[model samples]
Target: MQLALPGFEDYDRVCEGLQEKATKELIASYTDGREMNPSAVFICKTMINLSRNFDILNAKGRDTSRVMAQLLSWFQELEDKLPRASELKPEVAALLGEAKA
Candidate 1:
């Protein structure tokens, strides 16, 4: 997700390219119009925000230790909150088993 965010600009617009604010909000399943992330959305938002500035700061010779730390932490949190489907094989198998039963 962190890798995709830099290229996609917004995680919500993964393949669709940059989109309108409403579109991103909708795609991210944001409600109350807030991007607080029921779990991972906010982390994505923070990563996007951090990535945008980190490069510029680094180029300017500004230390980005804190920003990098925060960004890395968010990435870890995002992974914990919403792991890839591949990483959830056991959970997926359990769910599939339940559905079949």
Candidate 2:
């Protein structure tokens, strides 16, 4: 099944761009003897959270394809924002590691 969000036809491109920018920024920060910026960390965390949620949704016998597409769309919308600590609970991580096969 194919699931997509309207007006997000360029979502893959946007995600790739964000990843590239974050990687460059992180490298520059490290080279300059500075800590990685919050924005870069936020991008990585956002991706990780999305991945974990997708895994959980799939393992729960849910329609993960549609939900994953929507989650990616939401992430695309909030690419510039940082996630709260409460959003990344240990329970969520455990769910991601559960059996889905």
Candidate 3:
């Protein structure tokens, strides 16, 4: 069941559109070069953050399943470009650790 509200079909697009080089680098840095699914990792991280704020006024418990599907699609579309991402970007490792609360 798609939960995308009107005009919101692009949510997954934006989420998945996070730069491939950046996303893969971030994953590599965090995972220490272990191969991992970039889309799954990105979506999981985004959803984790989203879950924290879901009850906020603007978030209003938006349907996350729909968003996840979109992200996955984006990831699949970009899968081929992920291989060389490790050497192409360094900023991916610069993000602060996730909140520990």
Clashing pairs in 3: none
Off by over 4 Å in 3: 1-58, 84-101
Q: How would you encode candidate 3's per-residue C-alpha lDDT over 1-101 as one tens digit per residue?
A: 57888999767545332333354554445455445576646654664343333323225545556545554555454444344445544564333223322
lDDT of 1 by residue, 35-85 (tens): 244666666766666765676576678998987787678767766776544
* lDDT tens per residue, model 2, 1-101: 35679987666544343334544454344335323466655655555555555666656667668645754665554433433334556886567557443
| Deviation of model 3 at 78, angstroms | 2.0
- Which candidate do you rate higher for TM-score, 1 or 2? 1
RMSD of 2: 17.0
> In model 1, which regions exceed 4 Å deviation?
1-37, 89-101
Give each model a TM-score.
Answer: 0.50, 0.32, 0.26
CA error at residue 5 for candidate 1, angstroms = 25
TM-score of decoy 1: 0.50
Question: What is the C-alpha local distance difference test score of candidate 3?
Answer: 0.48
